[model samples]
Target: MRTLLDLVLPLECAGCGVPGEQWCTGCSRALYVPPVVVRPRVDPGVPCWALGTYSGPRRSGIIALKERGRRSVARPFGRALAEAVGHLRVAGEIDPPELGSLVLVCAPTRARAARARGGDPVLRCARIAAEQLAPETVLVPELLRMSTGVRDSVGLSAGQRQSNVAGRVEVVGVRRSRSDNGGARTGSCTVLLVDDVVTTGATLAESARVLKDFGVPLAGALVVAHA
Candidate 1:
């Protein structure tokens, strides 16, 4: 199924540029380590975990997916997220209620930015992670959204970054857990926020605040990297 363009341009690892593989074994191995608990500048009132610092293969992979449009990298990123969730469950850091589903809510991005980037890479990764953990897990992709006119947080101070996203994140809808047979479940489920990176944790904190206001039960947040 190799196309002519692929044959001419060739496939290169998004993380390390090793030819012939979209994601090389070495780069994929880099993301398989134990998840590290991180304390962000702004706490979201819940445990925050990251795979690693935003460097090396992690940075390259994120850039490839977000800026270069190398969508294939989402598979490895999603698998890493699923593994992290499993680790949290094993360590007792996260516990989904009995007979209820574990919901993965993707941190929202600005619609304009997402449109320019082809789509939301973070949401795509979250969906894949939910699929890998499914039957007991579900994905709520549009549970949150960034309101219009919010500035980017690229070079803002931690406080400034927080101010930028505060009051700008809006919850669109609430999703209740469903059973394996596709029937509605009754008890409360745990909501875990998923994102690509955690810098000052401004966005995550804001997201948790809105979800809390909406009466959603949140367990914690997970990110691919901690900046």
Candidate 2:
């Protein structure tokens, strides 16, 4: 992991460019805002909650994780994500996610992109969040796979984004919930999609659609930032 790589690399604050801090407390707090629920106009099953807008320290931190290989920031963001998810409540879900019942699924990064980045930072972040939030809750890293030939959604209009990812994500594995201790957990397994950021909500929507088709419908979604 990148954190292991940090033994040689210096730790720097991703948000404010401060020295000797992977992620400053102030910067972390800046990301701890009220979660915004995102539901695209077309699909509603995949409602998502975002910590804040994609700007400021949050944006800088994400960029640092994805591009600069600053893996230290993932822990704080993971903890922040855990807190946000703890407070998130979706319609028809009265109680908090029961232990071992919730599973966090990372939105699939393109295979090409994953190789380019050395690995998936989003998946790493989601794994940490799931561990910190509930060790009983499983984290499924390979649950979703981007359909072949899917292009990057950047700069595309909302409609285009939706169209681009439509039928472009598929479930490639069996949905199962297992604790960190290697024992299978009880309760039905329901997915909660995790992403680094959400803009038009198309990717998450399409992901939810695919998962639902596989009979693993989403409980909801959690993203670090909303653009």
Candidate 3:
């Protein structure tokens, strides 16, 4: 059953602007490849698990969601991200548990970016991943904004990316604590940083630095795509 507007108006594909398909068949085919689990220690201080390379339809999809205001598309993109990093293990993987413990901490986007995009796309994707992995994992939003800057990581080298965001993240707030209302304090918990894409991993590495300083156990990073 189609609505009057749906029938009267045309809908172009998010990826290729093709009519009828939400994502054009050609673009959908470009969204992914067999998932590649890359242990990228590119950020030195922080470890990361990246999925597919940034190119073709995958690149188009990410751009559509980020710059083109396709918030709804993040669901499928997030699903792809989760699948890419789901069974990951190792320092540069899905934040390997020290004694079998897993916690997910989504990276915080800048206020300007959030405002420009209408909402936080990375957080949206991370929330989807959390919902899909609920009950089996402990996912929480424990990271906070420590700086106000933006970096374009499209084609920069690893070292350039590292310098771009150095000393950019800081940890604030203690969750599960009674200090807010004066109740029993549970202290801080371990965290695994989550994001939508990783070019040089500057953001994730900075997050790890903040968590480590705050006494929270630092796990690796998780992402949907790598460029």
Candidate 4:
């Protein structure tokens, strides 16, 4: 049975107008045909990897997931992100052990924004991607949280984006255990920050800084698309 929502608004490829598919095979082929490796001008060491540029179906699909309430699209998006991770491995950009040991950390969404969207789209994507990547992989969706009133970075200049998110996000949850001597155990896990898109690299960079305070280092970042 077709879903009422689908019946009301027929499903079509976001990249090309094809009936009954969100992302067709042709677009998927385009997404990773040429691996998109962005040497972050902001932070060189943490090279960014994306499945495709944020245009056409990629951008439309992302917007559908975040703003248009198409949460079902996350499955394909997650698999694509996993594919990007595989690309990193194939290019020798990431070691196998590190990839297995790394935790997936989803970018933080503002409290109000998450409520309005019904849930955290990025976190869902991160969780799904982790599942696709490896069975043993852990996902720390709430590792970071943005401060209230942090404005969305859309349409903002790079400098403006930096200022908007500066001092506005921080680590919230780090598990602590008592040692034999009753001392607290510090965080010792590496994270792979995941986001829907990477533009100015401000958000991922800022997330790395916040995680550093808690003794968690980021191996790199993965995203569905790049701008």
Best by lDDT: 1
Listed in order, each prediction's TM-score against the native is 0.89, 0.84, 0.71, 0.84
lDDT per residue as tens, model 2, 57-87: 9899899888877777788788887777666
> Which candidate would rank higher by lDDT, 1 or 2?
1
TM-score of 3: 0.71
lDDT (tens digit, per residue) of candidate 1 on 1-227: 33343355679988898988988999998997779999999999988999999998999999988887677888899989988888888888887436356788888798899999888999988888887786655755588899997887789999998999989998776453343422223135767999999999999999999877666767899999999
Against the reference, the lDDT scores of all candidates come to 0.83, 0.75, 0.62, 0.72
Candidate 3, 1-227: lDDT as tens digits: 22343345477666566777656657644543335555555653655555567765567777877887776567666666555445554324444434444556777667687778877777777777666665556565656563676575557777776776677765545553434531211133335677767766666777777666655666567676776
Q: lDDT of candidate 2 vs native? A: 0.75
Lowest-sum lDDT 10-residue window in model 3? 181-190
Model 4 poorest 10 in a row by lDDT: 178-187
After superposition, candidate 3 runs with Cα above 4 Å error: 1-12, 16-18, 23-41, 89-101, 149-160, 175-190
Query: By how many angstroms RMSD does model 1 differ from the true structure?
Result: 4.1
Candidate 3 RMSD to the real structure: 5.3
Q: Which has the better lDDT: candidate 1, or candidate 4?
A: 1
